[model samples]
Target: MRYRHLAAASLLALPLVAFAQTAPAPAPAPAAPPAPADVPLIARTQATVPQPVLGPVDQALRVTPATNAKGGKIHMLPATLETTQWGWFDNAQPPVLTVKSGDSIALETMMHAHNQVVPGTTIEQIKKTRTDYPGRGPHSLTGPIFIDGAEPGDVLKVTLNKIVPRSYATNFNVPGMFGEFPKEFPDGQVKYFYLDLVKMETEFLPGVFIPVKPFPGTLGVARAEPGRYSSVPPGKYAGNLDINEFTEGASIYIPVFVKGALLWTGDSHAGQGNGEINLTAMESAFRELNVTVEVIKGQKLEWPRIETKTHWITIGYDRDLNIAYDLLQKETVKYLVETKKAPDEAAATKLMVTNWDCRISEVVNVVKGTYCMTAKTAGKPVAKLPTAETATAFVTVGTDADLNKAMDTASMAMINLLVEKKGLTRLDSYGLVSAAGDCRVGPPAGATKTVVCQTPKSLWRTKTASK
Candidate 1:
């Protein structure tokens, strides 16, 4: 049951509405560049807004992505910063590392077997590795990477680049693990696969080949709730989503929760069918996963969805297929209303009935789910959060206490632009300058001028209704 609701973030109605009709308008030119490191943002804020603790701005906000010397994306070690310790995905857990939008991460994921099924591994020995795994689900996880500037009400785009197979991968079915036909295979089954990374496929049996469609079966961010969370269920936050669409070259867009969108993923599956009815995909230990994780501001989503080269996939999970089915349809309807902006909800439903392909994602994860995909037009990207390099101020608001330092925390670029380029006095710019706090345009209460992201008006036609 815990594994069933592996997704942690809930699917709320979003304002990033471009789902229905043809192409969305082209995005306007990006605002100016990030202010020079030496410039300060302290001059144009209210006396109350807190100055931000200028830690690493992270390459995410920069013009180019962060890179390493080896020409590979930054490598994330399981035991390193921001990475998770075991398998469970808890938002309350601190991040092992901080990355930025458009950053590539090459992470090594532990197998569902963890260290249980090595060459001399045994069942009795494997049980010890699953010590606290009952509610945590089965696999070992790698991270809770903190993406800079990510926050609740935003979106995180996970683009799969590559899945490098490790030397060997393992698979097993416990006695009661596959509930549908529990009696069919009573004894636990442990099997291993010799990875063929070069060929990109694995053998199920002689002459029976299964293409290696490696995807993180349990990829997601923390739920808004603060506590230990199960990696079993797939929710809006997309943990253990298990959908096959998450294979290489696909993109998963998830709603952001908590600042920096604490994200983690694992449960590498070399292959699996839609229902995963028999339990487990072609399980594998991935040597490396090349992924680009970025933040999309101004986009809102109710569910964790997928965009492949061919389809727009909507997902829903629940304890009951019937309920999950309804949730799936409702999400489709929301897709019609928000993204499609269908004037008639009923009409959208009718069209959806004709176009959507709803399939069983899984039935065993106590939390069953149905994922529906519809033929979708490609090319239009969800309008991004505004990027005003100048004239706009930004800030980070953690507690009510941070308000006092707002002025100091504001971007120096904003102050410089208004005073130097735009010719507004510091106080006047502070008056009209807006942070994400309160939308008041001119010195309205709580202007909290700090590094902030606001929706650009032109993209109003872009998508979801704001909460």
Candidate 2:
């Protein structure tokens, strides 16, 4: 019986006896739940704040309305006059106003004339005489917007955001009136070369396109005296500086005067040369300016300074270039010694000799001036320094072979720090890095096969030091 059972088992173990058979297979891990479709694609976008507006005046400044048959009507806001004058005074009281840092202001002018399209005339002269002297007529002008808190010793910082010219006309040069070259030049002899603005294009050259930028030629704060001041010359209070820098994205520092810094701004120019040689730029009707004002306490400046994204310019005005240059040099030397606090005179002198970069703002203007030299500091030139909450750190984790993964992870961390920890707008944070950041990866020191990441010392230090 045992032999028969063994024989049967052996027969069952044979390959032909069992043949082949299979069971069902399992399904794939669910397909990843499809990922959320609402995730943002872009990292950031530039943001802008709404600008503020100033309407017709009240008790602070006297407001008067004047009308014209040809041009239209305008609202005039005059400053408190200590004394009254019959003619155009060289020192006119600057408009008084108030503002804070980061606020954008716009000035609008409305005026009318019989010959809507003539040029080369003062607004007062055009209105009273009522004669089309070919090139001389009253062109409506406005502003030298005075910022509040600007005083005798401090600087008034103005950041121009935008300037627009809504209307304009041309003035043909005529004999006997102002701006006539040589007395012998006949009256109305100059052809009608002036442009009457239905709208004309500004061409810098044959192929280049120049956008129209309008600003007040006479922007300045009020004088310190109790009496009415003239508007002709630019003084410590800042009037009629004729600085071309009043354009957009520029920061202008004006000497402060009086309490609340009575800032009056008007007389917007569509465009003009440095000297205003012909006594006019693209004389037009009404200009709009978007500006921001800031007051620096206890900052006494002898003259105004201007800064832009690219340049740090100093304005020195005097009777002679030598005097202006001397003043500029003195200011530059003081700035270096005081602000930078170079170790000693030799160190300061070396800095000036080795790294100083300077240039002329405009040499031919009637306002004899020399814009002294200086190079913009080599780093992010922000309007204000970064705060701890806004700062960021960039760390290097590994060699080049692993750089891509490291950067990807590091960037995610940075985003998290900005959005979750710092409570800043994601767009602003990204923009800050974009405009003022740099990254590099290269072979590590003394390591032939390894690489390290690096960034500008200033930015990196600022992030680490919270300064």
Candidate 3:
């Protein structure tokens, strides 16, 4: 989210709601001055862009093996994980990582303020980085992973398997970049926070401790457009959504624009309210992101939607709140009709109104969003998950070296991960392809120290001739 202030017109005319599990207001601080803008952005020549290597699955990017808490093997993504290089939601940018649908990803994420705003960082350093850093938008995002067979009008179903905060987080207030009350705190201020991951709490102020619910602030796919778009707002393809419900165990469905559904994610927030209220939160670098992104062919979506194990949620986004509300209504109705084939519109409306509640997903972004949440209790059903299918390629999870060793013999088409083998074994299949693990034998998880192999297949068939 931007921390720069603009003319009064930028302020939300409506009373925005900063939804939270428990909101305890912090004491007031001085009005902060506006944060500085980055230098203007001009498209770079192809020479500046790093052309993808040899093929979709880079042999060189193979990662080493690592152990999960359970001592089973998991993957950490290839060192090629995007942190330094990032792009807008525009389809123009090439995907940094490529995987078939149902592949598991152990992604790493960075804080919004980025390296310049980290602890021990100085204003001078920030100003210096701004000179070279493209100023197209705010937040440091990683991704745009190309999903095989994904194309425009498809929906990417992302399941957040695990999210752990790497170390510290940050919260800042820059003059023009925060809330409408910019004059209240002149000049910007950034604060660092030490996390207690084991305890799963962080101190917001001296007396209050905020529960940590880590989620990427921005999660989106490249838009089909040729021109670059700013990541400062939420869109139909999804970005900077700041939806708090998207924590671990949640599933988000984002619209696909490109053939691979270049999904990008970053702006890690340890905890945040709906409106975000301020410009930042427990913004932090993240480690051990266990996510599975599946492509549901032909399931077109207009806006991004989310679902927790207990609730089915639909989203509506627009610059106009009224328009957002109308869209939300339609989305809810459509969901009901598709899932239940309710007798009539009135019955569907009654079911939604009587059984559901709404949350203002976010109001601070230039494009606001609202979500309709329906409970999934005893008999009530939730969104249908993608049925099991064969995996297109092997998604090897382990440390880089472990994966490399395994690939040496497995010699199958491999997408390596550097991970926490969370739930890697629970799924009988990896969508379309059978998965094996431990880097030595196959692709999923095991405690072995060598390359795991999958059963022999066609050209890409893998072997487990242990070394």
Candidate 4:
């Protein structure tokens, strides 16, 4: 099933999920400003209780001995200024913590804006922090946890074991920050909530409560490139995906780029919607989050893929929604072919249209995201997808800031593939690709925008002879 988006105006008017856990409703908050004409009356309030103070930066990165199923060592990572990256993913950033391939991490992740947003903290204070860190992302990512054996082209298997969050959260959107409805509400707003950890829910307004489904909003390995990259837009390395499906019981496979797969994760969220329209969710910190990392050698992945009990998710990112959708479709079809789930491109398309579910991952990020999900039982289950190089008729254009240039590069590559590999005349190759080639956008963020085009492998398969 797809995730739901929580609209800004009607916080509780939209549908919400029900959980078995229950608790007494919390008291109303102290009245602050009167609701705007468009905002709900119940939504205007401030926390009377003092927010829990988070940290004094831990001087030394430390780990204590703990047990796991694989008998792997556990590392306890605290969310101190010294431990977390302010707002960037840089391959050059040295690892603050190192672990074995199969070791588990019992870690703490901070809230948005580098754990600066808390009860009684004013919007002006947040603005000052923004000015303080001029070019960095707001997410307080906690690592560059170098796995001892990970290498380029390998896949890092991350399994979510547990996530328990702190007692409060903040949700906000800045006026000029390009949220879904920035123009409608000129004066941006910020709101807070008290999470009942025992019940796993949070109070949004007087009677409205949202379930506390916690997940790390940003998780990725170091990029192959050298420079520091903003953590706002997610790319091939899967940073700031903001996908809610990455909760407890879900596993994500990330393609490793740099040596040791320097993994970093943060941007903790108590809960979020499908699109994260207001540019934020119940942004909060985690008390204790557990994950197990393993390095799978020989296998490869062009983009990140997620797995849960019932579904397998494929992702795509691009500035254009349509191109993002196409990119998702391309990844799905490519996965189907390489995993032997579909006989060919035509069959894969049929399967997708008939059974898969597509949803928007997010819209607020600079590079928008779209993803598709197919039930685990749709076909023979694949433990992992093969490398993109295995495909005979596919070309992936690397990320570019310009969307047009990215597509053009992919188009040219496809033209050459048809001419050189399929033995078609150059003119015919161009026409054929223009008419039948499927183009999709892949990982995109900051200055990276990737486009991939794949023609049917059956195009080169020997046709049957007829009498």
Q: How many residue pairs clash in each candidate?
A: 58, 38, 57, 4
| Model 3, CA-based lDDT | 0.56
Residue 123 error for model 1, in Å?
Answer: 3.9
- Name the better of 3 and 4 by lDDT: 4
Index of the highest-TM-score prediction: 4
Which rank order by TM-score, best down to worst? Answer: 4, 3, 1, 2
Q: Which stretches of candidate 2 lie over 4 Å from their true place?
A: 1-102, 110-148, 169-211, 341-366, 378-467
lDDT of 2 by residue, 248-325 (tens): 687777777665565555444555433332233444444455556677887767777777777666665654434554
List the global CA lDDT of all models. 0.57, 0.41, 0.56, 0.69
Candidate numbers sorted by lDDT from highest down: 4, 1, 3, 2
Candidate 1 positional error at 292, Å: 1.7
Note each model's CA RMSD in angstroms: 27.2, 33.3, 21.4, 17.6
Give the least accurate 10-residue stretch of model 3, judged by summed lDDT: 426-435
TM-score of 2: 0.48
Residue-by-residue lDDT tens digits, candidate 4, 64-114: 666688988888887766677766667877787889988899888877655
Model 1 lDDT per residue over 1-467, tens place: 12222222321111111211111233486986889999976555575788786664343332234474434346455422234344456666666667767777877776553434455566445544444233345666787788888989999998888877566655444444343334533555555666676766554433334456677787888788776655666778888777877788899999987888887877777766554543465666677787888788898798888889888788777766556656777887888777764667898787676554555565556676667776666344433223343233332221122321221233223434445644555432321222101110111124332222221122112123311
Q: Regarding TM-score, does 1 or 3 come out ahead?
A: 3
